[model samples]
Target: MGERVLVAHQPAYWPWCGYFSRLLDVDELVLLDHVQFSERGWQHRNTVADRYGRPVRLTVPVRRDFGQRLTEVRIAEPDFRERHWRTLSETYRRAPHFNRFADRLQELYAQSWTHLVDLNEAVTRLILDALDLKVTLVRTSGAPPSGTKTAALVDLCRRHQADVLRVGTGAGAYLDAGLLERAGIRIEVAAYAPTPYGRARSRPAGLSVLDLLMHEGPRARAVLMAGARTAPFTSTPREVHA
Candidate 1:
C-alpha cells in the first residue's frame, strides 16, 4: 500500500485541538460525516462566549422528529449563518479581545452560504488554507462503501489503499485494534499535547485551536505539529487519552 492516512472524525464546527492534532500527523484526513451524532456534542453545536466572557453556543438545527441515524441526518436549518452570527455577536460582543477578530469572523459568517455540507467543506478548506497545511481532505460521502462505525472506517482505509490507520487518541476505546492488526495494518493514535500560549484571559493551558490562533497566528502551525504527538498501538484507553 502507498503512504496514506485515514482519520474518521465527526464533522465539528471550527474543530477542536484533537482534530488538528490528527491533521498534522496524517497525509489525508477523512471526515466521518456519516457517523451517528452523540447528543449535546460538537456535531450540532459549539461554544463561543457572549460579550460578557460567558460561553454561548452556535447550533446547527437538526430534525427533532427525524429518528434517522446521523448518517441519514442532514442539517435542517436554512438560515444557519445569520443565526450563528447573531448568537456569536451577542455572546462575544462583551469579551475582552472581542474586537480583534470579531469583524473578520462575522464577515465570514454573513457571506452567501447555504447547505451544511457546503459550509462544512468551506470552513474546512478555509482553515486548512489559512494554516497552509498540505494534507489532503476528503469526506466520507465521496468514499466508497460508506458503512457505519468500525466497518465504515476500515472500509475507508481499504478503499484509500492505506496500510496504516491513524486514529485519534480517544477513539481506541471504540475501535477494534486487534481486528485491524489481523487485517495486516497497523493502528496508531495521535495526541494533541499542550503548547505554551498566552491569552487575554489568565486561564492558561491548551484550549481550542481558536485559542492557539488568537494567541500565536501563523506560528500556530509550528506549535500544532510539535505539540501534537503520534504513537503506535495500545489497547488501553489511557495511552489513547494521553
Candidate 2:
C-alpha cells in the first residue's frame, strides 16, 4: 500500500478548487467536521458565474445550532440544490467541454444528502470517482476522539498510522505540524494554483475547481496531479467566473 496521509479541513462548498486540488497529494482525506461551523464559512457559500467575468458568492442557509454537530445541522435552503444546479449549468453550458460532462455534473448536484459529512463525502466522491482515484475518504467525527481540533487530526493520523500528513498552506498558521514530524510522520503542505480554462460562455479565468473539472473532464485528474509543476503554492485570491 502507498504511504497513508491525513488531510483535515473545514467543510467547503461545491466548486471549491483548492480542496479538490489537495486530494491529489494524499492517500486519505479526512474532513474536519467536528469543528465549529463558522457563519461565513465556505460550507454554505461558493461562487458561480453571472454576466460578470468574476465568480460571485451564493449562500445557503444552515442552522445556527453548533451543538448538533456538523453532520446533523440541517441545510435549510429549500430550493438551494436546484438553484445551484441551474446556475452552474447555465454558466458552464458554454464551457469548451461542458456538454460532455454536463449530465454527470447535473446528476451529482441532484442527489439528496442529509448530513454535512455525507454531503462533503458525496461531492468529493463525485469528483474523484469521475477521475477513477481509489483514495480512502474518512470523517473526523467517525474517528476515535482526538482531543482539540488540531490534535484531533494528529490523533487521527496516529490512529491510522499515517506516514505523512498532507495539509494546506494555511494550516501552518494554526496547526502544530512539528508534533506530527516529531512523531516520525513526514509533513507536506500542498499549494493550489488556479489555471485558466476557457468555456464557451466567456467567463474570467479560474472561477472554481468545478469549472476546471467540468470543462476538463477526464483530464481534470491529471490537471490536479500536475499541480506541483506550477508555483510553490497559491495564496492569491482571485475569481474567474461569477
Candidate 3:
C-alpha cells in the first residue's frame, strides 16, 4: 500500500500560508477540535495586513470558559462577522485578485455560525478549495478519543492507519518522535520558509492564507507550495498539545 500520511492541527481561524503548506503535503488532515480552547492561541484569530501594510488581527469573539474545549466554545458575537468581512474587503479590495474571491468569501461571512469550530472549519475548507488542495479532512471529535499530547497524536495515527505523520516545525518542540516511531509511523517535520505573497512593499510573515489567495489568485497554490522542506524528526517539549 502507498504511504498514508496524516497531518493534524487545531482548527485555526483563517490560518496562514504555512498551515496550508502543511495540509497540502499530507493525504489526510485532521482537525483536533476536542482539545482545550486557548484564548491566546490561533484558534479564533489571525493577523492580516491593513491598507497601510500594518499587521492587524482579525479575531472572533468567543464566550470564555475556564476550560472549554474548542468544539464547545460558542461565538460571543455573531455581529463580528459583518465587521470582519468589512475589514477584509476594505483591506484587500485593491488586491489584484480580491474581486475574484471576494463574493464567495463574503457569502461565508453571511452564514450564522454559533460555534468557533464550525466557523474555523468552514473558513479552512473554503481556503483549501480555493487553493485546489484535495486532502481529506477529519475531525477528532468524530473519531475515537485519543489520549492527551503525544499519546493522543499516536492514537490518531493508529486510528487513521497512517504510515507517516506530517507536522509543522512548531510541533517539533512537543512531539515525541519515539512514540510515533514505536507506532510504525514515520514523522516528517515541515520546515516552511515563509512564502511571500501580496503586493505590499513589506510583506508580513504570518498573515492569513486569504492574503495569498486574494493577492495571487490562481497562482496562489504554487506560491504556497514553494519553499517547503521536510526532514526526519527530532524534538523538545513545549505547550502545543495538538
lDDT winner: 3
How far is each candidate from the true structure, as Cα RMSD in Å? Answer: 3.6, 5.0, 3.4
Worst 10 residues of 1 by lDDT: 198-207
lDDT of 1 by residue, 88-157 (tens): 5665555444576576677678776444555665666656755667777677655445455666667777
Off by over 4 Å in 2: 50-52, 66-68, 199-206, 229-242
The residue-level lDDT of candidate 2 at 75 comes to: 70
- The lDDT values for all models are 0.64, 0.65, 0.83
Clashes of 1: 8
Ranking by lDDT: 3, 2, 1
CA displacement after TM-score superposition, residue 34 of candidate 1 (Å):
2.2
Please identify model 1 stretches exceeding 4 Å from their true place.
Answer: 1-3, 49-54, 69-80, 86-104, 112-114, 143-148, 200-207, 240-242
Residue-wise C-alpha lDDT for candidate 2, range 12-98, written one tens digit per residue: 666466677766655666666766677666776667655345676666666678555666667776567788778877776776667
TM-score of each: 0.78, 0.81, 0.93
Residue 110 lDDT, candidate 2, scale 0-100? 79
Clashes of each: 8, 8, 1
User: Could you tell me the TM-score of candidate 2?
Assistant: 0.81
